[model samples]
Target: MVTTGHWIDSSWKLQKRVLSFVHIPPPRRGVEISDAIFKCLKEWGIENKIFTISVDNASNNDVAIRLLKDTFSMSKNLVCAGKLFHVRCCAHILNLMVQDGLSQIVDITDNIRESIEFVNRSDGRLLLFADIFKKVFPRFRDREPHYDCCPSEEDWVKVVKVCNILETFWATTQIISGSDYPTSNLFLQEIKRVKLVLDNGVNDEDDFIRAMVRKMKTKFDKHWGECNLLMAVAAILDPRQKMKAVEFYFPQLFPSNEAQENISKVTTVLFEFYDEYVAANDHDH
Candidate 1:
């Protein structure tokens, strides 16, 4: 079990290091995981400094988070009262949603993959490759009697739509999971960008795409149904975005009924955190 740490140092630069990579004995349930995390935090003497914990979607992780929240609640000084303590890993959630969507088109993908492998497997096949894949595809369809697996033009259309839908997800994952840059400040817009694509996808006239997107949206909502306020708070923190980013994107990110409510929640959380910061600063003074 690896507990990694990421923070901005006094120099205002991104700093990351592996805090602990300890072995967890069998029966790694919520209690065990929480115990491990808590021990690691205390060993580093930064348990109280923790703002949030990110983990992939799992029942045990959920339980572990709740356990940790209860433990941390003992600290009266917790910022925003530990409301932001549990962060569902964005990359992990995206992988789940994307996997759900891709599974819908397994046959389509398999056909395409097999076809590509057929053509790229050897120098002889490479010699026959046309400058454009599409141009070569038809001749391939006609020449190879055994290539019954070639995707139809209709299947290719769905592939195009799938690629378009995943473009934002790919970009967001890249942006948020970067090793060389600070990602928190960039999370707000990247997340909204993904919502935009999914929203557009569900409306796609093509049944294949609409069905796939609906599945993905269900997973998206399951994990992020309630707006992760931290994303919005991050928006407010970014000088380039601030509250306006939430104001502008909320309407599109959520259902019409939930958008304003979510926006309100974000502002409320932001002010609550600010109040805590002010109180803490004054106490320090």
Candidate 2:
């Protein structure tokens, strides 16, 4: 079963240690859900020995935080109140990157939603796309043909975003160019931009990577327009050097844009350790 949250409690009785598990059920009733889990723990005779509560960056999970606070209010003597609640999940931030990134690109967002709809409505179409995709990139060998992102899955959004991006660049060069399709120089420019991002050829060596990093940082420092969530995500996804570009700018670079409102909302629920975890995990290769 897919699990999002789990809690463990321990107690010391002189030389003996006792432990118990608290499984936080799937979110059904908003933030109050955490309270239910805590109540269950109390009933099980698990005292206030919660070292940490790890959660994803979901708003409802934030409700869990509020619920914890409320529970503390009820039994101040029983709970420490300031127990560590770590809200750090790397996959979650990656998921958020897709949401924030693609939302800025209307074409990317529209195409992905449409593609998912097209695939879900017809099994044959899904098979066809998978077949064609495999032929295009045989390394993606899989028995059953399936779209990267199914509308039924939350992480499906990331799959769709990645596929749309990769496909758009590939199609632009091999299919669109020198074809009957009406193409513009502007389209070619966008394709080039995408290619530069995909290839990450700007940073070949230590010096080159440093130079590119400086240039990007300079651009970010000078420009005050917006955070360009898509651009930020492209940098985050850059496989070269473990997204050093992102490490250079953490909480400061992230929440600077209006597009980051949702991200901010989520981050606010996280403790300090959780934020650092987010920074470190995204920096991981």
Candidate 3:
């Protein structure tokens, strides 16, 4: 299924509507995907109004966008080329990173999942587990336990620490995935928080947490080491933040020397985009 949306009003909320939901059998090729998207746009009579396309972090998506760019080139639209036309789904990238981190504690997760399944399979099992829980903790005999199985104190401590670390990622993901608000400009700030969480976790006393965070950091760096230009431009254009946000965050995002060079490059690009917009508007007028 393919869907399309646009930012609505000054508040920048996504107003999404379904475009196509045809069942296309795999193995799906880049050309086929591009053709479907192009066909949909043409049908909607908005082929020339193409802007950024957000897609999951799949290798075939890269190819699909390249094909889409070629298709767009046939039109007179000048801005439908290069990085300006491609915006990767940040939520997908975050999911990949979190999954990588979670893999380190798969055994614990599997055990928990299995225990839940066991208890949920039958009412008898649940009653038995609850009875055992009351016997195990006499102080809590007056109250019913929410869960059937109780984890060991050590296991419980580890779970709490893990949840605390993951809570940051979970919250950030929710913010970025908001369809009711602008996410592009907010990406840099949220991602910086994610990096901070990972950095802090790396120094944790618990070896398990540090190891998990180290793995996640590797994946995070692989996907988002350098900030994307679309995100930078969006942040720059926001009246509340403007360029100060970039100036404040880029130093931490890059090495001391590279930070200055990146800022200069980003500023140059921003101006170039501004010039293009001005020239286009003048021509339209």
Task: List the global CA lDDT of all models.
Answer: 0.84, 0.43, 0.79
Candidate 2 colliding pairs: 31-63
Model 2 clash count equals 1
Encode model 1's per-residue lDDT on 182-275: one tens digit a residue. 6766776777777778888888888888899999989888877788888779878988888888888788777888999999888999999988
Write model 3 residue lDDT over 72-163, tens digit each, in one string.
77774646245578888999999998898778767667767866675667787567767776444332322435444445556657878888
- TM-scores for candidates 1 onward, in order: 0.87, 0.33, 0.88
Q: How far off is model 3, as Cα RMSD?
A: 3.9
* Candidate 2 wrong stretches, greater than 4 Å: 1-31, 73-83, 86-88, 103-285
Which residue window of length 10 is worst by lDDT in model 1? 126-135
> For every model in order, what is the number of clashing pairs?
0, 1, 0
Output the better candidate (1/3) by lDDT: 1
lDDT for model 3, please.
0.79
Query: Model 2: per-residue lDDT, tens digit, 1-285?
Result: 122223322542212122334455555555556656566657656435443444566677677766775665566422223433333333343334334434444454565576557555877766766667633222222333543532333334444544554454445445323323322222323433443443352343434333433443333233322333333343334455233443444333334554356344323433343554575479555
Candidate 3 clash pair list: none
